[model samples]
Structures are given as structure tokens and as C-alpha cells.
Target: MSERREGALDEATIEARLKAELPAWRYEDGWIRRTYKTAGWKSTLMVINTVGHLAEAAWHHPDLTASYAWVEVRLMNHAAKGITDKDFALAAKIEEVVGWQPGAEGGPLEGTPTDPRFAYVKYDR
Candidate 1:
């Protein structure tokens, strides 16, 4: 029998949280998932590495599915055998780091150029 975490969220709670907190993420089949589309292989690798680093730092790992132009991140508390606060927290951090756009914010750090030749990520419009 799988052990559930103390703070395991029910389906309704998960759905509500996903909608309110992580609009791009969805809960399905016992996991919260998000797919980030990149420019190509290089960007895909970058995305994977970034997620890896964040997961390591947070000590909460996620399952990643990658292709030449996209990466799908799925998060679930394996030990708990259910979606928990840890999963939601990690997912929120990943979403923040992965989707950051300095250029659009007019920050000092210019994000990747808009030119296709130098573009890395396909930011959601």
C-alpha cells in the first residue's frame, strides 16, 4: 500500500490551485504537468539543466520528458504517492524560473534576442 502525505491535496484542491497559481500547468493522472516549448535542441537542453538544478536545490525531483523542441515536466510526490504541497511548491518555482522574461520587463539584463537566429526559448505570447 502506498503512503499518502499528510498534506496531500484532493482533486478539487489540486484543480483549484493549478488554476489559480499555475495557469500553464494541469493536473491529470496523478500528476501536475507543464510543457515548455523551446526553439530547438540547445534550448531544450538548457531547460532540462535548469530544471535539474532547481530540483536538486529544492530536493524535490520531477519527471521530465524532452524532445528536440520541447520539454514536459511532471511533478508528484512519489513517497507520498499523491500530490502534496511539496509538488506544488516545486512546480511554482520551476514555472517562475523557466518562464522569466527580462527583456519584456525592461530590466537591465536583456533576455535572449528576439531574432530567430539567436532565439532560445519560445515564450508564451
Candidate 2:
């Protein structure tokens, strides 16, 4: 196997960066995590699948736990054994996809799609 990469940020650096860049995420137990609440089971599944797609595309997977109404995502660079730029990039993409609102400027669902099947609500806490 190839040698593990370096450049994992220290805890203090991770904490400071997370605070500024991802306020919704917390550094805990050697991982950066964020929990998103959804409107219901369907929304929860949607969130999970969306995260999975983003993770796969970025090639930086996160640890995920989900219930009927919430999903928690935890990110760390296992090869580096700490937080890295990969984690933050994936997290930002996840946040953007999850928090998108219909009719928002330049949104895919611009003009507000009328289909109830397309509606997915993010629970704000």
C-alpha cells in the first residue's frame, strides 16, 4: 500500500477552522460532525442519499447515522488520521445540497416546482 499522506490539521486549527467555516459542525471525538433534522422519514432518506452521492463524487466518505427524522454526518481523513481539506470540502458540498431551498437564486428548482413529491424540508434547530 502507499504511504499515508500528511497535513492533518491539529485540534486547535481544526476547531478554529470549523468555527469560521462550518458553524453547524462540531469537532468531537477526533471527528467533525453535523446532524441535520428533516421533516420526516422520506426527507431523512433523501438527505442520506444526497450525502452519499456527494461523498462518492468527492471520494471522501463520511461516517453517517440516520433515523426517521435526522441524519448525522462525521468526517475525518482516515489515511491521514485526522481532519484534512477533503473533509471540509465534502462537508461544504453536503451543506449546500441539504440546505438548498426551492426558488432560491440560481437554484435547480427555480420558480418553485409544484410537485409535492419534490418537496423536502430541512428541520432548523
Candidate 3:
């Protein structure tokens, strides 16, 4: 269910809404970021696959990075060029597939990805 609030929603409002509605993604700077910890590279691969399904379902994709045990996700609406209700709304659905939270420690991952952290994870499945 969606909650309606008065006034124009900004970063704080959008972030807050994402936290409550999504319950998994945490608000950051100008976007929503979520990190996943896996057991190994293989597990990370699977996690990437799962995220693919999540992004596809939401129709709102995120900037993701996975190396060995960590998969970091960033959500933002590029078309709109800033954080908007649509961005958070999509983030909420993405959270349903992969758990996320604001201010919650990712607890670190075992390995790092071959490329830079901003590198996106592409999944066929």
C-alpha cells in the first residue's frame, strides 16, 4: 500500500518514505543504496542474478557492484534527473526482493569486485 502526504517531497521525505515503505533500503546523499553480503564469489553471482529479476520487475534499475561477498546497490531516476517519488517507489519494490536498510551497517564483504565499486552488475537470469 502507498501512503500519501502533503507538500512537495524532497530528499528527506523521499528517503523517509523509502525507509518506511521499502523497509529495507537506506537513504543516502541523493539516492537509495542497498548492500548484500554473500558467502563467496559464486553466491555473489547468484545475488546478481536475483537483483536482475528485482530490477526488471520494478522497471527501475540501480547502480550495482559485486565482487566476492558484497553487492552494493544504488537507486535513482535518471530520466527525472533527481530523487523523486517514482525513484523511492521503485526502490521499495526492489527492497522486497533484496533486503536493505538505512543507517544499518553492511558488516563488510569478503572480497572486492574486479572493477570499480560503481560498476554495474549485469544478470541474464
Candidate 4:
């Protein structure tokens, strides 16, 4: 069999890593993908901008799809033509930032109000 690209993980390794590290993401069609559900259009745009900023800063971009209330992010190392460390790294960061719930952490940052009218991301319970 042809060897995988350098720094690219085998499917088994990728699966294990995803299960252990990023439960919200899945391996599919040669890429690692995650879908973040938002409260509405505003939240969707916020998520897109956040992902864009991080991807640009990391210099590893993901293919994004958005609807009225959800955004899907798919990451792969195009140069390597496989799933590499970069994909996992960016996915982890995206999960961390997008899933953050300061209110649940019991800190000064109360996070967004619970009212539906002001809700942003539909945080995972």
C-alpha cells in the first residue's frame, strides 16, 4: 500500500484521537468535520468569523458551510492530502473557543443571558 503523507495519521489513529480528544468531530470523506449549531443567523455568522480568524492565524484553513443556524467545518491538510496534526490542532481550538461557557465556569464572566432572545450558540449540554 502507498504510505500515508508525512505527518498524516492513519485512519485508526485518527479515529482514536477523535474519540479521545474531540468527541464533537467526526472523520468523514477524508476530512475531519464538526458542525456547530447556533441559535440563529447572527450566531452562525459569529461562528464563521471566529473560525475564519483562527484558521487565518493558524494558516490552515477548513471548508465551511453555513445555514440559518449551523456551521459545518471540515479540515484536512491539502498539501499532505490527508488528515494531519494541523487538522486536529485547529479542530481542538475551534471546539474550545466555540463551546466555551463562562457562566457554567462560575467566574466573573457571566456569559450570555439565558433568555432565548439573546442566546447565541446552543451550547452542548
Candidate 5:
């Protein structure tokens, strides 16, 4: 079998990277995690699906926990036995996709719904 080679980052480096790049994610128990507060169940599902797609594309899956109004994404390199660049890369992508807020001065007006019904609200911003 071909061996998969991956190098895990030390705790100090991981902490610095998390602070600078992924401010919302927390380092705990050998994993970096971030919880996204959604508008409701529908929004929750959207977040889950988005995460799934991103994870699949990156081939670096994260541990996801969902509730009626929130989803928590935790990333770690199990094969490497610690946090690695892969985890951070996926985490950044997840933050970008999930935290995207459309609608600018000249940007497309078709952004996330402001209406309570369809909007994927974020409690922590």
C-alpha cells in the first residue's frame, strides 16, 4: 500500500495560525473547532450541506455536530495524529463560504435573505 505522508504542526504554531487566520475557531482537545449559529433548521441543513461539499472537495473531512439552529465543525488530521495545514486550509474555506455576506454598493442585490423566514442568521459575528 502507498503511504500517505503528512506532517502535523506543533501546538504553538497552530495556536498562532488559528489566532491570525481563524479567529472564530477554538483549539481544544487536539482539534480546532468553530460553531456557526444559523437562523433555523432549514439554515442548519444548508450549512451542513455546504460543509459536506467543501469537505468532499478538499478530501479533508471534519467532525460536524448540528442542532436545530447551529452547526459545529471540528477539524484534525487523524492520519498525521494532530492538526496540520490541511485542517487549517479546510477551516479557512469553510469560514469563507459560511461567513460570506453578499450585497455591496454595486454588488448583486441578490444576497442572503434579510427576511427572518429564509435568512441564515448568524448569532456570532
Candidate 6:
């Protein structure tokens, strides 16, 4: 996770991992995206702030938006033509940090994978 070490996965491997690790995140226009819903705008701000920290720490930033009750993340590796290991790993951690639980309008970890709170993310566009 430091200095972008050689990427543990190659292109093909990263793609497959993305599907499993980022089940809530979909690829659109070559960017990985996921949505998060919160109880209100305050919670939305909390998620946005937290994600900002995560992104800064990981050095793999995302385009984030926080509205009245939702937060969305859009990730892309400009250096890479498509999804890569960095995106999958970052997505995995974001899901965990968000703590999305079931029946809770947030992303949750199920047979596929998610977090607590049961809500998933989406693109506004």
C-alpha cells in the first residue's frame, strides 16, 4: 500500500479481484463507483470526511460527493486504462470503514461482500 509497490496483481488478476472485492462498485466510463446512504446529511458529511482521510492515506484518491443523505465514490487509476489492484484494495477498505449493515440503507457484507448498514453506492450521473 506504500509507494504503489509493483501491484500484487496483474491486469487480468486485478479485474477478477475487482468483481469480488468491489461487488458494490460498478465500472462506468472506466471508473469504479459505489454509493452510500446515511441517516441524514450530517452522517453523509461524516462519511465524506472519513473517505477523504482514507484516500489521502492510501494515496489512491476518489471523486466523492456528499448530498443531503448520500455519499458516492468514483475511483479510477488514470495511469491504468481500466480497473486495477489499487482500486479493488481501496474499495475493499472503504466498504469496511463505512460499516454498512443490513436493512440499514448502507452497503453490507453478504455472500458477495459489503459492510454493515446495508446501503450501497451509485453514480449521480
- Per lDDT, the best of the predicted structures is 4
Clashes of each: 0, 0, 4, 0, 0, 17
Per residue, candidate 3 scores C-alpha lDDT tens digits across 36-98 of 666567767767777778778767787888788778878766766566666666665655444
The sequence of per-residue lDDT tens digits that candidate 4 reaches over residues 1-125 is: 03588778889999999999999899999999999999999999999999999999999999999999999999999888899999999999999999999999998999999899999999876
What is the clash count of model 3? 4
Model 5, range 24-123, lDDT digits (tens) per residue? 9989988999999998899999999999999999999999999999999999999998888999999999998888776533586667767887779584
TM-score of 5: 0.89
Residue 107, candidate 3: Cα error in Å is 30
Which residue ranges in model 1 land beyond 4 Å of their true spot? 1-5
Superposed Cα deviation of residue 65, candidate 5 (Å): 0.5
In model 2, the Cα lDDT at residue 1 comes to 16
Alpha-carbon local distance difference test for all models = 0.90, 0.83, 0.62, 0.93, 0.87, 0.68
Candidate 5 or 2, higher lDDT: 5
Q: What TM-score does each of the candidates earn?
A: 0.93, 0.82, 0.61, 0.96, 0.89, 0.65
| Model 6 Cα lDDT, one tens digit per residue, 32-120 | 78888776666688789889899899999998877888888998776664566787778888888776444344545333134445334
Best candidate, TM-score-wise? 4
**12-82: candidate 1 lDDT, tens digit per residue:** 88889999999999988999999999999999999999999999999999999999999999999887788
Which regions in candidate 2 have their CA more than 4 angstroms from the true location? 1-5, 106-119, 123-125
In terms of lDDT, the poorest run of 10 residues in model 1 is: 1-10
Model 1 alpha-carbon miss at residue 81, Å: 0.7
Model 6, which residues run further than 4 Å from truth?
A: 1-15, 100-125
Residue 110 CA error for candidate 4 (Å)? 0.5
Q: How should the candidates be ordered by TM-score, best one leading?
A: 4, 1, 5, 2, 6, 3
Better of 1 and 4 by lDDT: 4
Off by over 4 Å in 4: none
lDDT of 1 at 106: 85
